[model samples]
Target chain A: MFLPMVLNSLNPLLKETFVNELLKCNERTKDYGLVLTPEGAESIIEARNNILNSLGRVDMGIEVALGLIENFYTSTFINEENYVSVLNEFQEIFYYMKNETEDMISDDKLICIIKDYYENLCGGSLELLKSCLEEFIHDFRRKAHTAEAGLGGEE
Target chain B: MEQRDNSGQTLAVQSKINSTNLKKSQYTIALLNESFRVGLMSREEINNIQIQIMQILKELIARYTKGESSSVCAYTAESILNSILYCIDAYALGCDSPEEAICHLKSLQISKLYERGVKSVSRWLEEARELYKKVRKNKLNVGLESYDHTINEDIPLYFTNCGIVFDAHNGAASIDYQLTFDDMSINGILYMKNYLEHLWIENAFCKYFNSEDIEKLLSDFGRTIGMDYKIELINIFELVFNNAVFAILAGIPEGLRISQYHFDLLSGKLKALDDSEIDKYICQTVEKLVKNMNICELNILDYIYRYKTVFTQRVIRLVRIDSLRGIILTEKEEIKKGYTILFENGKEMKIEDFNLFIKKLMKLKNTEDKIALIKSGIESLNDFVDLLASDCLFGKEFEALFNELGDMELAILAKMALYEEIRSDFRGLRSVISEKKESRVEWHICFVEFLKKSGIDRIESIERLLGEIDYTEISFY
Candidate 1:
C-alpha cells in the first residue's frame, strides 16, 4: 500500500512528461513515414510503466524510451501499423537486458548496442534480437572475469 | 482522559510526557508511535508524513541516477530510503524531547530534517576523529592484538571508508576491542563517537598505573582463566581496576601488585565477614583506592562508581563460595628446576635415509631391534610423528614401544597431542581427550588412543610427570 502510494504520486507527472516526449518523437519519425498519435503515445507510456514496475526498476525520466524510439523509427522494417506494438516490445526487452547486464553498461552504450543488433545483426527480428542480447551479456561477463583475473595476477 | 493506577485511583493524564521510554537509535519511529498511541498524533498526520518521506526518496533517487535513468532497482531505492530515514532520525534525536521531535516532524519538511541530520552526522564524525586521536595517544602499551587492531586498523579504516551520503547509518568498522560498558542503542557515526569517548575515559583510568604492572596483572588473570594472556580478548582496564580494588582490600593500597601472601591474608579476612560487612568493606576500600590513586576525572570516577555495586556483589558471591582467589589473582611464579627431559628436535633426515631406516626397522623380526633402529635413526620429532602416523608399528609392537618409553617421553607425547587440553589440571586430561575425540593431526589421535589403553599406573605417572614438565621450555614440532 505504501509503495503504491509512492508510485501513484509519481505516476501522473511521469506519464504527462513521457507522453509529451513521445509525441515530440513523431516530428523526426515523420520523415520516415512514421507518426505517433496521442493515444498511441499514452499506450506506449503505460506499457513502459508496467514493464519498469514489473522489473522492479525506477526511471528518472523518459530518456531511454525516447532513445529507443529515436533509434528504431528510422528502421526500414518498421511501419506505422506495427509501430506502437514494436515500441512496447522493445521497451520490455530494453529493461530486461538492463537488469540482466547488472547495470554495468551505461544507458547510451546499451542503447547503441541494442540498436546495432536490431538493425544490422538481427534484421529487425525481435526474437533474434533477444537471443543476440543474451549472447552479448554472456560474452561481457566472460571478458569481465578474464580482466579481473589478469588484474589479480598483476597484483 | 483519566487513567486508573494500580490502586484503582483515577489520575488525569498530562499533555506533555517524559521521553524516558524512547529509544535513542530509533528516536523518530519511537516518537511517532508513542505520539500516535497517546492520541497526540492522528492517523492522517502520520500518513502525510510518510507521503513526504516518499517524495524525498523520489528526489534522492533522481539525484542518484543523475537524471539519466528513469528508475533504479528496488534494492537501490530501499537503501536510499533507509539513508534518508537515517538522516531524519539523526535530526529528531537532536531535539530536546520526544514531544519536541514530534512537533518538528509534524511542522517541518522532511527534506529540511534530512539536511540537519546530515550536518549533525558530519559534525559528530569530526568529534569522533578527535576522540580517537586522544585514545591512541593515551593507549596502554600492552600486547593485546584486539586492542592494537582496533586502534591501528579498524578506526582508521572507518574514517576512510564511511559513506555519509548513501550509507550514513552503517557503522563501517568491525570494532573488536570491547569497553567496560558498551552502549548498543545508538548507531552510525554517533555510536562510534560515543564508543571513542568511553574508551578515552577507560584509557585515562588505566594511565594511572605503569603499563608493565598492567601487563603483569593481565598475564596473571589469563593464567587464572586457563588461557594465554597475549591472544585472549580480555579487557585490560577491567583487570587492572578489579585487581586494584583487591590490592586496596589486602592493605596494599599504594600498589597494584598482589602477591600470593597478600591473597592468603585477604582470603582469611574476607571469609570471616558477613554479606553486609563485605559490602561495607568493599565500598570503603573503593573510596580509599580512588582517593589514593588521585583519579580526578569526574567521568572516570563516575564510571568506576557505577560498576561498584556489581563488583561488590561478585566479591560477596566469591566470598560465600570461599573462592575469592578467582578475583584476587596472585602472580604466577616461574618453575625454577631443570626439566628431566629437555626435548630438542633433531635435524631432519634425507628422504633416502628415512626410507632405508623404515625398511631396516620393518625387516627386523623382534621389537627390540626396531626400537633401537628408531632411537638411533629417527632424529627429528617430525620423523617420529610421521613414523607413528605411518602405521609401521602394529598392536604388540605399539605396546612394546610404550613399555620402552620412559614416563617423561610419554608425558611429552601427551603434551604435544593434547596441547589445548593440557592446562594446570593434568587430571582432567583423560576425560577431556575422551570427550574431544578429534585432534589437529592424524598422528595426534593415534598417539592419544595408545596412551588411553596404557594401564592406570602408567596413566597416573604420565599425569604427574605432566605437572613437572615446564611446557614453556619445550617446543612442539
Candidate 2:
C-alpha cells in the first residue's frame, strides 16, 4: 500500500552504498579469522533492509551492521560457519533494541551493552542473550518511568 | 478543434486554471497533483520530488537522533515527512498561483523550497506574536475564564513549546476562546496568526465603546442564555456586534447600550415588518451603523459585513417567531426595575402551629377546603412557596388552589416558575411552561401542569403580569 515508501527503500543507489560499506568490514574482521565475501555482504545488506522494513524503521547508512561486525568479531563464539547468520540476527536485535530503548541510549553504548550480555552474561548463546536483553529492557523502562514521575513531582 | 457557434463565431475555450483547486492548507500536495494532472509535470518529476523529500527526511532524522541511531519508527518518520510538506505548503501558498508554485517546484531544489518555507513560517510566527500582543493590549475587560486562559496561557504556551523544526504545521495550543468569524481552513502558525489578527480587529472594534457598557452587554447576554457571564465562554465580539446593530436599529443616541425600553421599542418596530421588510431594514441599519460609527478600517468593515448576512437571517427568524428579545438585550438594572414582585415573607408560624396546620389541611377531603385552609394560614409569598414545597397540597388540591388565585397571584406564581426563561417580554414562555417533561422540583412540575390546563386568557394575563411585575422591588418582611 505504501508504494512510494517501498520505492524509497528499493532505491538502487542506497542498496549499492550499503553493500559496498558492508564489504569493507572484512578488512577488520579478517585479522580475527572472520571474513565476509561480497555475496555474503550482499545477503547481509538484504537482511538489514528486510529487518528495517519489517520493524517500520529507516536507516540512512550501514552504521548498525558495521557496529555489530566490529563489536562481536573478537568473541570466541563467532566463526566462519556462523559469521553471516549471526551478524544478520544481531542486526535485527540491534534495531529492535533501538526501538525498545526509545532511542534514548547512544549507538555505541547500546552495542557495548548488548556485546557484554552476549559474552559474559549469556556466554554467547543467542537465545539466552535475547532473553537477557528483554529483562534489561524491562528494567530500563521501569527506571525511565520512575525518573519521569520524579521530574513531574519536582515540577 | 475550434467550433463555430450558430452565429458563425468561434467558441471561446475555457481554461482549466482554477485557483481554488488547491487547498490553502495542503497547498503542496494539491499543487503537485494539479500540476501532474494537467501534464505540467511528469510522473518522473513527481517521483524525483518524493525521492528528494525522503532524502531530506533522512537528514532530519539524523539530527533528531543525534547520530546515536540511524533509524526511527515509521510513525516518527511520517510525522517528520508531514512537517516537511507543511513547510513546503507554506511556501507554495505564498506564491501567486498554483501554476507559479508548480513551476518553482519543478525548477528549484526541494531543500531550497523547504528552506524558503521555513523562512515564511518563521515570519508568520513572529507576526502571530505581534498580533497576540495587540490582542492582549486591547482585550475586553470581561471575566470569562476560558477567554483569559486562551489569551494568557494557551497561545503563549504554544509560542513557547512549538517545535518549528519537526512540527511547524502542528497547532500546539488548546485555544478555547471562540471568534464570531473564525476561518478553520488554515492550520499551524498561519491559523494562529489569522486567529490573533482577527481577534485584534475584534478587540479594536470593541474598544470603540466604553468598558462598562460592554460589560453590561455581556452580562445581559449571559442572562438571556441563563448562564453566569463570568464563567460562560461566549464570543465577546458577537455580543458587542449584535448589540451595536440593535442600538443603531433602536435609534439609541450613541454607544452599544440597549435598555429594556429600547429592546421593547425595537421588538414592536420589528413585529410590524414582514420577513423581506425586516431583512431590508437590518441591511439599511447595518449600513447606517457603519456610516454613523465612522468605521474606516477596511478589515473591521469587512469583518462586520462578513457577518451581515447570517446576522440578518437570524434577526428575521427571531422576528418571524416574535422572539426578537433573544437578540435585543436589556440592562440588568432595567430588568430589575421592570419585574418587581415585592415579595415579603409573612411572620413564620410556630413549629407546633405549622405542623397542626399541615395535619389539618391533609385531612380535608375536599380540594376547596384544603386550599382555603392553606391560603388562610400562609400569608407570605415565601410561606406559600414553602407550603407548595412542603408537599402539603395533594394532586387535585394544587389545581384547586391555582383556580382560586386571582390573575396577579397566578402571575406571581408563574414568574417564580418561569423566572429563568423570562427575558423582557416573556417571549416563548408558554412553550416552556407547557413542556411535558417533568421538572426535578415537584412543585414546579405541578404548577406548570396547572398552567397548561388553564384558559388561554388566564395564561395571557399571567404573561402580561410577568412584564409589569418589578422583580427588584421584591423584599422579605
Candidate 3:
C-alpha cells in the first residue's frame, strides 16, 4: 500500500498502472508477520474510535501528538550497564522525589541526570531530541529523492 | 465429601500462566520501544535491529558521551526518530498515520530499544535454572561463590513484597525499575519457586507411591556388590536431575515405552554397580551396613530375618514393609506374603500374626502389658523348644514335635468321620493309632486346623483305645 502511494507521488504515469492493483491488494491487507491484515486494520480503527470517544481527543490532529515517542526514550531511560551505580546516586539526590517502589530506583535521580546532562552536555538535549524527530518526513523525502537518482543511475 | 476433578483446575492454571508469560514478554518489548522513539535509539538489546539504528546514532553520541560535538548528518538520524515518534503518538491515540510508517520498520525485523529495566525476565529464569544445576554439580550446597559481592545474590527478600502502583501522574518513566515478577512472567524467582514446588509435589507423590521408584531403581539395578557412599550417591542424583530434566525422565521401574525402559536400564546399571566399579552412587541405601559386607537380597526384612546377627551387629533398623527401596540381590518375591514359624514344641506362629501383634502393641494404651504377654508366649514356647533342642529319645523325638498331645490329636482326627475308628488326638495314643484319617493333603491340614479351632483339649476316645493297647505308662499331656 505504501509502495504504490510513493510511486504514484513520484510519477503520475505510474498511478494509472500500480495504484489500482495496490489498492486491491490492500483491501485483503494480509501478510504473515507484517500484521497489515484486514483483521489488524479493523482492530486499529476500533481502538482509535474508542480512544477518540473516551478521551475526547477526536479533534486532536495526528501531528499534535506525534512527537512524544522521541521525548520518552532518550530522556527518560537509564542505560542498563551503568544503572546500578548511577541509579544509587540518582536515588540519593532525588530521595525526596521517590515513591515507595522508586526507593530502589529514584525518580529524582532521573530528573537530576537529565538536568545534569542539560547543564554539562551539548547537542542531544530533549530539545534537540524533539527537533530531530520533527525533521523526520522532510529528511525522508530528501532520502527518497536521492534514492530515485541512484535508481536512474543504475538504469 | 464430593470429589471435584481438580485436575482440570490445575491444567487451567497452567494455561493461564503460559498466556501471562507471553503477555509479559510482549509488554516488556513495547516498554523498550518507547525509549527508541526518541531522537537516538537508546543502547538496549545490542543484537536488535532497532538498536542497530541507534548504533549508527551512537556514532553521533560518542562525541556527546566524550564531551565533543562531532559533525554528523543531522537529518539522517533526526527524521527516523521524528517519523517514529510521530507514528508512535498517533498509534497511541489510535491514529494509523505514523504507525503505518513505524510498522514498516518493525515488519522489516526492526525492534525499538528499551532501557535495561525492561528486560526479559525469562532469560534470568533460564540462567538461574542453569546455575542451580551447575552449583549442585559443583557441590556448592547453598552458598554462591566466585570473587564474592555478587550483583545478583537472590532478591532483597525483606523488600520483596511490593505493591504495584502505576501512578499516571508520574507518567510511564516511574515504571523503569519497579521490579515485578508477574506471576505469569517466566522470571527466575517464579521458576525457582516452581522448581521447589514441583520438587515438593513430586516428593509427596513419591511418598504415596511408597517410593516405588526406590524399589524400581533397585530392581532395575538388579544385584550390586560392595559399599556405596552417601556423597557419591548425591552426586549421582545431581547428575540424574541435571540430565533427566523432566519428571517423565524418571519413570516406572518397568515401562512399555522403549525410551523409559532404556532409562530404567541405565539407572539400574548405575544403582546396582559393584563396589569394584564405583564407591557411592548418590543414594543413601544401608549406611549402617559394612562397606565390604556381603549384603545380598536387598529386601530389608528378609535380610533382617536371614542375617539378623549381621543386621543387629550393624544397626537396629526397621525395613518398612510396603515402601521398600533397597539395593538387594534380587526382587523380593514375598516380602508381604508372610511366613509361618513352626516351633519344635508343636506351635506355629504365622508371619502375618507377628506383624499384626507388633502393630497392635504400637496402638495399645498399655504397651508394657501387651509386650509382656507377647514375651511370655514366646518364652514358654522357646523353653519347650530348648528342651527338645537338647536331646532325641522322644519317639520322644516324635514326642518333642507332636508332644504327648500329638498322639491324642491323631486319634481324634482319625475317628472324626468313622463309625468305629481307632485313631486318637492324644499325643501318647496317636502313636499307636492305626485307622487312616483324611488322605488329601489339604484335608489333613484342615483337619489339624479344625482340631485347634474346635478348642477340644483332649481326645478321650483315642485315650481309651491306647489304654487297651497296654500303653498304660504313656499319658496324654
Worst 10 residues of 2 chain B by lDDT: B5-14
Tens digits of lDDT, candidate 2, B1-477: 233333444423225445677788788988778767666667888888877877888889888888777777777777777788899998888877565677678778999999999999999989888888888898877777778889899999988877767878787458998888777888888889999988888888888788888887876665554434665667888788888889988998788877778888899998898888988998898898888878899999888888888898998898888777777777764343343333345466766877787788778888878866876777667667767877777677788887777776777777677666653333455776755466677777778888988888878767655544544444322
**Predicted complex 3: CAPRI docking category:** incorrect
Candidate 2 ranges beyond 4 A from true positions: A1-20, A23-62, A73-75, A79-84, A152-155, B1-18, B271-277, B333-477
The window of 10 residues in a row where model 1 chain B has the poorest summed lDDT is B4-13
- The candidate with the higher DockQ, 2 or 3, is 2
What's the true lDDT of residue B286 in model 1? 85
Q: DockQ rank, highest first?
A: 2, 1, 3
Clashes of 3: 33
Fnat of each prediction? Answer: 0.49, 0.71, 0.00
What's the TM for chain B in candidate 2?
A: 0.69
Global CA lDDT computed for model 2? 0.78
TM-score of each model, paired residue for residue: 0.75, 0.73, 0.17
Residue B93 Cα positional deviation in candidate 1, in Å, after optimal superposition: 0.6
lDDT of each: 0.77, 0.78, 0.30
lDDT of 3 by residue, B341-412 (tens): 222333534556645554554454453454354445442233333322323112222222343234433443
Please give the distance, in angstroms, between residue B327's alpha carbon in candidate 1 and its true position after superposition: 2.9
